[model samples]
Target: MNLKIQKISILLFLFSGLSVFSQIKEEQLILDKKREPEVKKIEKKKTSVESIKNYPPEEKSQNPVEYSITNVPALSDFQTSTLQADDISPNLKTDYYSNYVRFGMGNYGKILGDANVSYTLENKLEVGADAHINANHGLQNIYAWDSRQTSLKAGAFLNGYGEKGKYNVTADFGQENYNYYGIYALNPASDVDINQKVNAFRVKGSYDHFSNEYLNNITFKSSFLSDRFGAKENKGALDFNFSKHDLELPLNDVKMNADLGLGLETQSTDFEILNTNSSSYFLGNLSPKVTFIKDKSYLTIGSGFTYLSTNESNLSLDRKANKTYWFPKAELQLAKSDELKFYAGVDGGLSLNSYASMLEKNLYIVSDQRVTPTETKYNVYLGIRGDVDELIKYDVSIGHSKVNDILFYQTNNLFDTSIAAIRNAYDFANTFSAIYDNGTKNEVNASLQYFPRENFNVSGSFHYINYKMENFDNIYNVPTFSAELGAEYTLLNKKLLLGFKGFMASTMVTNLYDVTNTGLSTNYTTTEQLNTKFGGYVDFNLSAEYKIHKNFSIFAIGNNLIGGNYSTLQGYQVLGAQILGGLKVSF
Candidate 1:
């Protein structure tokens, strides 16, 4: 496949995979107790961790067995609940610290920061604000296109408690800035600003009923986003549920409960191009469920319905943006004892493919593309979780799902002479495009946590997934298998702590288009083939913190201790042997 020499060099992009998925290797800090995501998503109608208010949060990487260091969606909506962070200093006093702050700096121009402050206005009223920063200038002596990046997020909230219910409202702002540094950086392109910036704002309100007839809780959120380019998105969502858990039933060893939910989603986007018109979509859901409870066991059976409507917002192929879907929901749990249990279930739903959620998966996705919803047709799963001994616990689950309009990521093909001039800056083979397909996904998630003693702990987890799609050759950029392990220990009367963690993933693949002549010069054809193969890598980090006074502590962290060459994202080189240290204060 040759002849279109100037553009066919896209084949030259057949570079070896850059590195293993990498995140700063360090033990989870800021209250080592592992916690689930506080902000909820409308992915499904499953039970999730209860949201907490004004508490010292564990490190957040971004959740499933949610890691405190990186937030990558491995199983889409299949979340693991066993990624426990060890509490190394069980003897340390923790209740007095009401406000917290921390800051640190490291090589590669890396900066780390987290702060949360709250004040009690009266016996039952409170307010707080929080901020987080994670940024790095560049991997020195690496690429040439100014590979600098930063993520900044901040938010504030007010809360009120009454005899009937609890109320809270919050406002948040965020910004992400990065350069489209890629192999294209080697070639000179002076007309565009390689730097990209996206800004976001959000408002949220929730009511938790202390006592009500059928209403349990309600939540609503609104968001707006804009990029340096002409791309813009506005979104709003409402989710609420009604439930009753203790109604007597005629069946033996059984009780009945009514579980119902209602949700609404609205979004609009401006793509900034004339031919590609702006679009909007709205999705609403209704779920009805019944659950039965027995001794240490329970079962839930239910179904859901989703209605979708769109305006000029259709998927690129196959799926239509406007449609209605019916799905199943059921779960079974059998427990032999408090130490062991078995579970299985089948479920499905529609996931809102908003601009913000897509960017959460791949930060480099093009900003000016049509967005739609992903339909998870069905998911059947089975698993067991139990305490192996007094010091150990384990959970393992396997699931298979039929999905439609599944979202995946791939490199945006570089422009060729057949097309008009580049319309955006992300066109240099540096940016990614969101791809959707109908397919099946098989996944396995296993996690183990050890608590032999109060001052030391160990945890490990493994995830494997395989994808077969109807419209694509291979799943791009996603690892086939990945695993993480970490441990921490405390000594010196629980004043000093040390910990280490590491992760690894299988090789990844990406395909691009190549032009070839079809016998005659006047006719031509294009074929898709593997153009890049990213190599797998293993990396780890070490951390230590020492408390000097009751209200103050100093800590140090080191990443990539082995100096491995890896990029959490393919083509992006991570800094080698990074070290960051700083102070923590509470008042």
Candidate 2:
């Protein structure tokens, strides 16, 4: 072993396996500090800041999940539930935020791969990589498991920051793979197999201080998720949380804010479908958020508490107590962009699980009688962005929603065959629920732009979506719509850039149990209830560049341009248009 001593013995065996995983996470944090008094009596109790009132000003960026806006972060705590950052759109583009590497091949033999890479320094370190894979087999496949079906995913990320802003750090890693084969028709000569593998990681830190109007903020986030199957045995998730926000009012328009957060999580499960064996469950959530930003208009309210415990094997929980959640979010903005701007927002929440006090619970007890905990929800949104001169621009959005309890699914059972009646005793009660007296969703979006000259261009977009669960059961009530138009033309005088695009989507309302009986432990028949479908497509893109001098120039691309045949879901089918080209150099 003399190749540099075999790379120094693989870097000393990866630093002795990261020092034995940091000494087994410091001996599981010393057994969670000896269960710190039963986790401090189940954590919950916070209120101070002169008994609460004026305190709005902390929002200088924090927490950024890919979507960048000066490095996002700050909704004044509530541990990000979703929504806000006003639909950041810089001419909306997707390649999922490219750092780029893409491969393609089509003409009825579809195959593609995608990649993203990242690195940043000087501004305070960062590292990244993301991947995607696509496969095809439906162009004519007599069989061979419909001729090959697969999906794969990969990921990695890291970040660091410090320089008067105090400190911060982040890390992540991920993986996923899926495959299916069984010549349809009840698995003719079935070889039916299943697989799952996942791993996740996270770490966060924050701190800040200021004087003059008094400001202070603090944060800490932790995460871990893991899964392994092949005979199942490795399944775990552990999370830790922390948050604090303080602001001294009078920064402007009657602003006020106060935020506090607390969190803890745990889960470990062993998997097996056809043989029977299930256990390991424990969940806990505690949240607190507060806000009041009144310039364009803002108001937020919040609350939370949830704790679940399980330890059986088959199932349980019709009532065993502990579950409380309440959330509220509100927003109002009218930038009136010198041209036009508008936005409206809303968030609602209510959850109570004491197994639903249906007169002291227990309607089917055992643990969670297949689960339906309890829920009450709400969501609403409206937006209108601006820009006119300088060659036109626009944005429009509308949304609506409401959902409750919602647990569903009923068949496919994913090859488990109910495990031979689990020792012969029907009604295992693993799936079925219907407290959806409320379930509605609506969405409308629009994007448009035009550039008269300066390189000639045009753009378009339209979308409509609706999902209603009026009365639940065997569900059905979906409506979808999509439209896209594009154009780009840059001449020999400006190098060369020619493009054309067209897209269409439909269903206008359809169902079949959203593409057939849902699986993965079957939930009351779901997957949106057999994805009823409709299709549309049209694409064409071409790029060319020649500066044969200066910063070195030479570019080329031709993608999908009219190879129509659509199916974004429902037996999934995508690929008609295909072509890939690449080459670039710049300094």
Report lDDT (Cα) of residue 564, candidate 2.
43
Which stretches in model 1 have alpha-carbon errors above 4 Å? 1-93, 184-186, 189-192, 211-213, 273-277, 313-322, 388-390, 416-424, 512-528
Clashing pairs in 1: 17-533, 17-534, 17-535, 61-68, 61-69, 61-70, 62-71, 63-66
What are the lDDT figures for the candidates, one per model?
A: 0.65, 0.39
Number of the predicted model whose lDDT against the real structure is largest = 1
lDDT of 1 by residue, 1-587 (tens): 23465224223311111123234332211111112232311111121222344221221101112211111111101111001112121122344655667677767777767676777665567787877776777654766456677767788888776655667898989887877765432253443557778899999999876542487789999999988877788999999988876678888878877879999989888766423436688889999999899987999999999998877743353323567889999999999785688999999998878777777666676766657678889999999887655566778899999998888777765544233344355655567777788999999999887776676667788999999999777888787888887666666666766665666777778765454545555433555557367746666665677788987888777666556655545455555666777787766
Please give the TM-score that candidate 2 achieves against the real structure: 0.24
lDDT of 1: 0.65
